[model samples]
Target: MSKKSRPGSRSRALVAATAVVVTLLTGAVGAGAAPATTAQRARPTVILVHGALTDASVWRHEVEALQRKGYAVLAPAMPLRGLASDSAYLAAFLKTVSGPIVLAGHSYAGAVITRAAEGDPRVRALVYVTAFQPDTGETAGELNARFPGSRLGPDTTVVLEHPGGSELYLRQQDFRDVYAGDLSPSTAALMAATQRPVETAALGEPLQGRPAWRDTPSWALVATKDNSLPVATQRFMTARAHSRTTEVASSHAAPVSHPAEVTGLLLDAIRGTAY
Candidate 1:
C-alpha cells in the first residue's frame, strides 16, 4: 500500500472526537411503509463512507460515478481508526447539508453510517455498498463475529499488535482476488497499494447509541462475492436493518471495480426517494 504519511497523531485524535457525537442506542422501526415520493426535488446530498484500510480517495470512482448521475455527492474524509471520531465527523458534516441526504458506506464504514443517521432529518435514505450495519450497542467485531459467517479480512502485524486484537489489514489477494477482482491490473494495484491502516479497537466496540438503519429508508448493495466481510455477514446485517436491497455479483470493493453498477444503484436510490 502507498505509505502516504498519515495525519499527525494528535490532530487525528481530536478530529476523531469531533466526528463522534451523541449516539442513539435503540433501533427504530424500518422505513418499509412510507408513501412513494412524487415531486422532483433538489438533488439529494450523497454521503459516501469508506471501509477500513482506505481513505476518502477509495470512493473516487464512486463519487465521480454518482456526480455524473446528477446528484450532489459528499465524500467526507474519515478516520478509519477512530469510531467516535469517524461517526461524529460524519454527523457534523450531515448537519451542514440543506436537503435530503442519501448515506452510503462500504465495508466497516457501514457501521459508521449506521450510527450517523439517528434523528437526523436531513438524511432521506441510506445505501450500503457492501458495508456493515450493526445494531445499537453492537460493536463491529461482535456484529462481524456472528456464527453463520466470518470476516474475510487479513491478519494483524506483530509490530501493530502483540497478543490479540489489532487492525487486520487487507492483503493484495483479498482486494485483487475477492474484493475488486474484476478491476484491471493497474487500477487494482493502485488501490491495493494505497490501502490505509485502521483502528484495531474499532472492530471490537459496540455502538454507543441507537442504530440509524432500524428506521431509516435504507438500501443495500450486496457484493455476493465479497470475502472481506463474509458475504453471509453482509446479508445478515442487511436483513436485520430491513433495507431495500439489490445484489451485485462482485467482491467487497464493488464501489471501485463496479462503479457503473454501484452508481446505477445510487441513481435508483435518488429516484426512489424523489430527491
Candidate 2:
C-alpha cells in the first residue's frame, strides 16, 4: 500500500494552506486601497470674516451650507475698529487654526484679511464677497468714494462722535433699502435692528502691508445689485487683484440672500488653491 499520511501531518498541511490564502487576500486588499489625493489632503479650513454693520450671525446660511459639504468653517466676530487693530485681531485668531486656511471677507473685512494674511504662509487663499479689496495705501472709504452707487452714506449715523473718530450704523429705516433690499421685509427688519456699528476710523485706516491678494490666489463675488458696494467697484477690485471672479444678482448681503452662490465660489477657491 502507498505510504499512508499521518492524521496530524494532514491537519498541519491544511492549516498551512489556509494561512497562505488569508495572507495573500489581506495583501491584495491593502494594495488596492488608494492614498488620499492632493485635493482631499489639501482642503484648508475656511475662515469667514464679516464686515461693518454685520456680525458673525450674518453668515448663518453660509455656515450651514459649508458644514453640509464637510468643510471646516469659522465665521469669527470681527471687531470693526481701526484696520490695524482688526487685522491684528484676525492674525491672532488665525494662530488658533490647526492647518492651512482659506480666508474670506465680506465688505470691510476684505481689507482686514488683506492685511492679516500678509507674510502669513498659513493663509492659502482669499475670497472677497462684495468686499473692499484695498491696495497697500488705499482705504475702504476711498474705494467706496471712487464708485457712487452706494446708498449707505445717507443711511449712516454717528454712534460715538469724536473729533478723531466715530462709530456709525445704518439707520433702521434705510437698512432695508441700502443693505438688504433683496431680503424679505421681516428679514430686513431683523437685520436692521441687530446691525452692528463700525468705527469710521476703521474705514479711514490705511492698510499696513502689501495686500495678501498680491501673492495669494484669490476669488471674488460681485453682487450685481449691491447698493452698498457698487458692482463696478467690485469688478475693479477683483481685476486689480487678478482674482477668479463670479457675479450674482444679489445685494451686499449675498451671504444671507444668495448663500448658494457665495458657497460655490468658496468651494472653487478651496479646490483651486494648492495646500
The residue-level lDDT of candidate 1 at 173 comes to: 53
| TM-score, cand. 2 | 0.84
Compared with the true structure, what per-residue lDDT tens digits does model 2 show for residues 112-225? 999999999989999999999999899998898897798867435546686767889988888888899899999999999998888888888888778999999999999999
**Count: clashes, candidate 2:** 0
The superposed Cα distance between candidate 1 and the true structure at residue 245, in angstroms, equals: 0.9
TM-score of each: 0.77, 0.84
- Candidate No. with top lDDT: 2
The list of candidate 2 runs beyond 4 A from truth reads 1-42, 154-156, 162-165
**Global local distance difference test of model 2:** 0.90
Q: For candidate 1, give the lDDT of residue 178.
A: 46
